[model samples]
Target: EVTVKGRFLNQRVAPCQLEVRGAAAVWGDDGRLTQWLSTQHAQGTVAPIAAANGVAETQVHILTPDVGGGFGAKIGAYPEELLLGVIAKKVGRAVKWRETRSESMVALGHGRAQLQYITLGGTKAGKVTHYQLWAIQDSGGFADMGTILAPFMTRPMSSGVYAIPNIECRTTSVVTNTTPVVAYRGAGRPEATAAIERAMDLFAFEIGMDPAEVRRINLIPKFLEPHTTVVGQTYDVGDYETALDKALQVAGYTELRAEQAKRRARGDAKQLGIGVSVYVEITGGVGNGESAKVEVLDDGRAVVYTGTSPHGQGHDTAWSMLVQEQTGIPMDKIELVWGDTDLVPIGTGTMGSRSLQQGGNAVFAVAGELVNKAKSVAARILEVSEADVVLDKDRGAFHVVGTPAVTKTWADLAIAEKSTGGLNHNDVINVSGATFPFGAHVAVVEVDTETGKVRHIAHTACDDAGKVLNPLLLEGQIHGGVAQGAAQALLEEVMYDADANPITSNLADYGFISAAELPSVTVVHMETPTPVNLLGAKGIGESGTIGSTPALQSAVVDAVSHLGVRNIEMPCTAERVWQAIQAAR
Candidate 1:
């Protein structure tokens, strides 16, 4: 039996296609499209699509409507999309091409098919000193980002929440005649957490130490500034020990352990298992910046153009809040426009948890600039020097210093500017840097030794993604991410037969998780703001996914630890668990 079973299968969903219509054409200088289809980078597509078509970049006009749901799979422009325009031009009619769900499964991008081997060493006293990981990534028919990025992403986070002195991680991506790999919720970072956390547990078990205490002994001391790991990840700020403490406290770790001991003493048929995982992930995507423009329209309403395209990160509401905070415009008066490159000519687009820190920072920066412009305009209009102007956020108006009686509404200043020129303020926030978001998750499960059934009971998590801008949205992201992570550990996987044909190809065959399989999560809040961006924030988008996957997988293994079970692979199906139990016997 493998002493260390670390299959951190933190992956996301498959591609589902819909009927698409229209002629794909280049945009003319008149800022009109010859024809179009659905995409996020409407304006951003012009140059690249035109170049590919041997036409002027100016000929491409892309339009993006609010997507139904992409998760990350729909971001690329495939050969089929390029062919749509060509076929339309050839046939002289609007071209419609839609793939069946089965076709999408085979042709579209797939997420997170990785195999990892981990080894961790520490003192018998439970102080982890070293870690090593080797991974094999299934790139599938083509070399997509998943094959190239996941393993590289794995190295930076190789040590996870522990302060290991020596660490090494190596991965090889091999292509197969299968669906191309792509980015999922947590991408490569989840695998790192999975490996390290499991190794920590194995170390703890071998040394007869409590898992929680082992984690505490090895975590980096709390740092208010950036802390660089031996692996070369510079965390802007973190309180990993506190996150572990909070998660343990919330899960009643001591009580659970006591219960576990009594159950073990009695040789109970149903065993209680507890799992813990602490993780820190890099966000904002390797220094790629985002863009935004805050324009005070002639009508006094605020319009924000941003490059961070969101599938469901609530960019609209979040961007509006950022603009209103700086510009003294009511949330209702602020409008967010994006994905239409004509309206927002430049943007990096959203993926990799970059929308807020990069995209929102751009909006915040430019909105502050717009307010400065408004201050000057208000000063001139109110017969006061620019230095004498101040903004009253409560009133959404600007007034002369110490002269509240003379005020100008944001709308009034915009109308004045439109009479002369445009552009109150516009800027693109560029950062050749990244932010790290950290968290701890605990999972409780009950395993039926007789039938080898695993039932997830309760879950508790403490995710610190820096300063939270919106608690509701952050929690929503956490809930969704946790679900996906848990599913990967216990129920989900993309499988192939001996012939390299897919076995789990559809919903009927694939183990897509539903509410019936999960328990509500208890979230403990914490924040250690990153200095990486102006928002004092990190990425919460993938935090839960990275943390929860290992926690659940470890819990299942923990439940059967008394059975001499050391490791069990992911999607811990009853059959697999039973087989492990039998082999141990």
Candidate 2:
């Protein structure tokens, strides 16, 4: 048996590791190198291969097959995965190399193991006066994205939805012996929200004020146009109070407290808790705009090529909806393709929740151009001026005024144009600008005073990603994001030993939350269309994650507040909770 020892950081304040070994063949080959990758950013992987084998990036063509899941860990190529190409070329055979779940935990990058100290000064009425946050980000050895990610995330969203005038936030990324940290779901935004929300709850506890009341006093007033935060981000548009009130009403906060009071009165084993978080995250900030190509084939079908790569975010269905809305193409007749460098050429692979707002809007823009181009072509064939040609979207045809009989279908126009100018007039159309999405989340948890165990009872989130192109797809994104956020709050953690050795290196020790541990998530949708893009859509991918983490953590602490426990660090495990309760007693 080939033995491997892996270490990882645990959710608790300790380091742990696991060992596993098996008889296996682990090498790279041409077939596996070309087949298994699921990302469009191939430069990182191709560079090392070209150096090892004396070939150019053009020689190494990466094709993404069905990607199971990439949470942000799969954005670039890994060293072991790239070795397949070198080994395959050297042996003149296709090679295969797949890591077990054990290897994946330590080798793959982890996220958000920061030690934060936050202080907030606010009025007795709960309006925030001044806020300060100091973050010691545990970067886990190498500074892979996390170093830059932490500062950028905290700077933009340190104040969340609050209208705080004085905000002081500083972060220092430190190196530790562990897996390198990288972007995961909301990236650094979740950590930022978590810190500030926790601070708000702490301030509420100190001043004997309600957490919700404190939030209300500090939240920015309802506004259109831009509202700049103490940090540098200018919120394009939001109604922070509306989202908070809606979430509170839907959650039935007062009723929940009454139930909690009853449980406390009876000294019941099951305790009740409530937590709330409001956040505004920056999406489509990975530069601005995205590339999209829409083509009307001779058969009258529409083909869309988007620069956004989707692992399971349902880009296919969502982009198809955009094409249908603009070009009157039936959903089944539209084919959406992505993640291939040759087909897409240039693309910022999906991360930072930018796909729908940036990439989807680009698709909408290209589809609109296709409609106008077809109208112009139809006008030429019907012997009418371009202004006289009108597209009947209901009929999916172009008809001249006062001439219903003289109509040309999209298919007819494309076929007829082959003789006049060729397959397509323009190869591609690019769209500009990015959109911001915001949300609020409420979490309820039960804490066992004796055992220090925290259980998530309920979670409700309200997210607005501008105009949702597809409700089904948007809800799925929120579900995944909330689960990840809860996991970070109550279970997931990356740890290191005194000698900088990693522990909790695999799934068994890593504390990744599963369905068995999670409660059914409640999602509320709000639409406040963004004026920045043509589709008026913002990104929904990371909003749930950014808004959920702190809510859950605060709820756990709130559950035992009567016992004199003021602050509790994240991942409130049974042991940590028990210790906090013991110290309080």
Candidate 3:
């Protein structure tokens, strides 16, 4: 039997605060308060302010312009935001507030900061049989979104990609004199994945087996139908093994192992280590669904209004592509609008990797509906039966099925409907359930045994995001996610002394990752379409972070494991690595 135990820390994210932005409000004489803010969710900001000020929801209005960055910090309504309206009414004038960079670091909500205790038991033959986990979450002086993450996010994914027959998990959140915890990029899922991956590596070390092979022997088989785990979490579909195979092949896993062996034989001070991680996460699961509006102007240009706010996710380009694909409108002619309560009053407001899967799905559905509406108008203008009219998608026109020359363009149809509500379609789309996007990542590192300095040499990531609409955008998202993941594993951390005074409170003190520190990542593409939404797409927003954090951490530990080291805590700094090595010797 093999027994492995370790404590994994998902350190707090302090720098993910509102940057160079402010909120302004004016109390109008008509008993309406209009405000403009830098936030990911304008609708989310409206209701709270209205309720706190003792006014109807319609009395409060919010408009969010281009936000620099949110990650997850701007999703909720803050005390200052709720007080802006009251302050404006009291002063009888417009009021505005913006935090300095130093203040933003401590005032804004933090993320992660969970301490996990994990244990795994398995046979000598490399089959994991039982797994147990206990997570202690730091809610940070207030019960916020981070309080429920352990139960709703970590516990549900405790089984991970493996088919362990017996599993037990428990979670507890304790209030501490730290910054309030909120969702970061991968939120609770990353912490869950990190815990399980660490346990798997430790178990492999105990049995003297290759970690990758141990994982392969225990992974869940690919399933098309919804499959539920022992922990009662149901996955829509997953092909974890295929993702693993692709990652290994792309990373030249055999050559890496051979190099490591040679280094060990020569007793080289610098050692090569390879690490692997397979992960599946939930997306498009935040709310019931999303809302979208598609309209054709008289000039034939299309417009899309979505409830999903875009801080930096490139929603304008993505939503336009969906409109062009469905309605035959050119990408350049499409316009996107969002984040204003008057313009887009109903919205779920982009979190949980839900934008592309839910918001884009809604746009795809509404644009298709607009096409049908245009066809009906075209049939009336051509004086033909609706069944006889056929749309020439390449030409963006409609005509009789047999005749191609005489056609009605989208502009013409819009002009004809000008007397009516115009050519427009808007609706809130509801999907059956959430989507699970799975992937694999392999990280290669060179560690100096004497000094315990680690250098990330190579990385290969295979993320299956389910029917990618735009490869450029997908790759960009993957690259960004990888950078953040690497930061959490090897560079970034938020620390405080015993009295709760932050030690690394500002950028100068924080170990933020930079481009110079990261290797050029090789992204391996794989697609498995989902049946839950119309576009058959899943979320790529958080996959890179989910896979890379564990891979990097595992690589650092594996580099010095021959010295009898079982594990080292995250942000595997040189000091920590050296301490572990000396203790092991």
Writing each residue's lDDT as its tens digit, candidate 1 over 109-185 gives: 88877777777776777777777788788887878887775557877788777788988888888888888888766
Which candidate number would show the highest TM-score if scored against the true structure?
A: 3
In order, what lDDT does every prediction score? 0.78, 0.75, 0.90
TM-score of each: 0.94, 0.91, 0.98
Writing each residue's lDDT as its tens digit, candidate 2 over 226-298 gives 8888777888898988999889888998998899899989988768889999888888777576778887888
Off by over 4 Å in 3: 15-21
> RMSD per prediction, one decimal?
2.8, 6.4, 1.2
* lDDT by residue (tens digit), candidate 3, 366-471: 9998888888899889999989988887888899999999999999999999999899999999888899999999999999998988899898999999999999
Q: What is the lDDT of residue 250 in candidate 3?
A: 93
Residue 64's lDDT within candidate 1 is: 68
Ranking by TM-score: 3, 1, 2
Measured on C-alpha atoms, candidate 2 has an lDDT of 0.75
